[model samples]
Target: MKGSYSLLDIDSSTGDVYLAKGASIGICLGAVKVPRVNPDTRNVTYAGTMSGCSNCFSSDGTGTLYNLSATAVSTKIRPTSVLGSLDVATGEPRDSVAVRRGPSAGMVVDGKNRFAVAAFTAPEGTSYIGSGTAFVPDNNATGQMVIIDLTTGDVVRTMSGFRVGGHGGSLVHGGLMNSVQLDPSTRTGWTYGPYHEQIHQFSY
Candidate 1:
């Protein structure tokens, strides 16, 4: 509420709001946790921070929070996944740590399947530093989707499609600007195609 924020998510299970500090185009600063009910009348607290700028934040039906992070790299930057929870009552550090890592950005939580689906649309190679904010992807590379286990933070599968710009094309195309849709019942998900006019879908 006091500082600048670029992205935010309400924990579906807890009602707590998370604000990610960032900009239209820049490196990651950090994040804050605002509890639904302020125990002891506290305003807010820093739940977590990382070296890589967080790309997205999502919470599952069960209140499990997830985020995609990109660290600056000379070669292609491999994104990370932060999975955990913040205490709903007082916003205690149940520890929303960076559990696992993958490629690209965009994500959705399938609580029923206990999985997080991410968009691996980063160009064949892109840096996470300046690119993290500008989100300028290679534009020539195809897009990909990744399925990660919520409990173990393990990437279970990956699906790909051509001409998808999520690799960073536009910060909005894949990172904070776009999204991934999931149908847990059918184990299906969707992503963006920055190079063309098409919505890519994947089944796993």
Candidate 2:
């Protein structure tokens, strides 16, 4: 069960196992047991972190939360490269990128079997690299949509610079985002974070 500090995954049928450490890490992993035990709870019970997060299932029938933050490349912070799957069971990932920054907060899997990551961004770099602030001026500004292709385990596209400067008196902060969904039937992706108020649509 993914919670404020721990990640747990349990296979309802076979009882396989997986786990991530820390409260923030666990939250990002999500919790499978919560839904089964508490019907009133929402799917996003667990939140993630900026450095250690991912979505995984545990052997105990629980969900997982994880982070996909940017990795250091030479001297600059690049989003294209990051550590492999934080899940020990999955070992290291092959084609994966930190689709989000400042703690990927939340993510949803589409019926098409692809993952659409929500994160902050600026300058439209190679990946999700934003200050995580909802809205900021100049260097701390945040805006962008990070898309991850689950099938290929790699970032397919990025919608960055959707907004500039805090609009409508809203200040940007590195916190939970409220834009990210997928339409299974149509294979469309949507992302609307605080920085970019506009709802973004995309096709795989």
Candidate 3:
């Protein structure tokens, strides 16, 4: 309750929701019970703090909570592009995997919980707020798409050098990479940056 809530996901298995908070300062995870009589007024229970977390997801089948940590705020304060796994039922951390890139933005897990895809935006300060737009292109920083093996928490593959962070007339507010969604049936994924004009698509 002390920080701003940024992202949220629901676990289909137990109907529990997980939340990520604090974008600029330290990050924390929270949860709330479902089937509430009033959705807007329901109370949220604090889980615990996860340093540098930008987003989180709950697997429908396995009830596993995945958290994304980005940025290099400090060596002891935050981690640069790290993925953390937590037990949904107990809120206990299971694993922490380091990503090759930094400042990761979004992530999505497959329906079967076999794999996940994460998006990385351009380096920090690559974009700045503009007069009429949410963001203005600055440095020619690009983005990356990374695929990971969920069970093993290993990087399967990485696609880099894509336009991001207000590059090539593409503008995004706050950060370049925003969110990632996956379609298990089609084996396709879509990455979105709110201020950008195009949607990034990839297949695996």
Instruction: Say which candidate scores most in TM-score.
Output: 3
- Candidate 1, 111-172: lDDT as tens digits: 88888776654433433553422244555545666677877767687665534444433453
Decreasing lDDT order of the candidates: 3, 1, 2
**Mind sharing the TM-score for model 3?**
0.66
Q: Quick one: best lDDT, which candidate?
A: 3
Native-to-model Cα distance after best TM-score fit, residue 9 in candidate 1, in Å = 2.9
- Alpha-carbon shift of residue 2 in model 2 (angstroms): 11
lDDT of 1 at 109: 77
What global local distance difference test value does model 2 have? 0.38
Candidate 2 ranges with C-alpha deviation above 4 Å: 1-106, 124-142, 161-174, 193-204
Q: List TM-score per model, in order.
A: 0.64, 0.42, 0.66
Instruction: Give the per-residue lDDT of model 3 (tens digit) for 1-204.
Output: 454454567666555566654244333333332211123456566454454345444453465666665544343332346677666457577768876544455667785748878765653322222222113255555677778887787889877655545222112111323356777888888765445677877786
- Across 43-160, the per-residue lDDT of candidate 2 in tens digits comes to 2322222244332222212232233333222222222323233222333333345444333333444424545454443533333233222233467545665566655656777656
Model 1 stretches with alpha carbons more than 4 Å out: 13-17, 22-24, 29-52, 73-103, 122-141, 166-174, 194-196
Give per-residue lDDT, candidate 2, residue 39.
Answer: 32
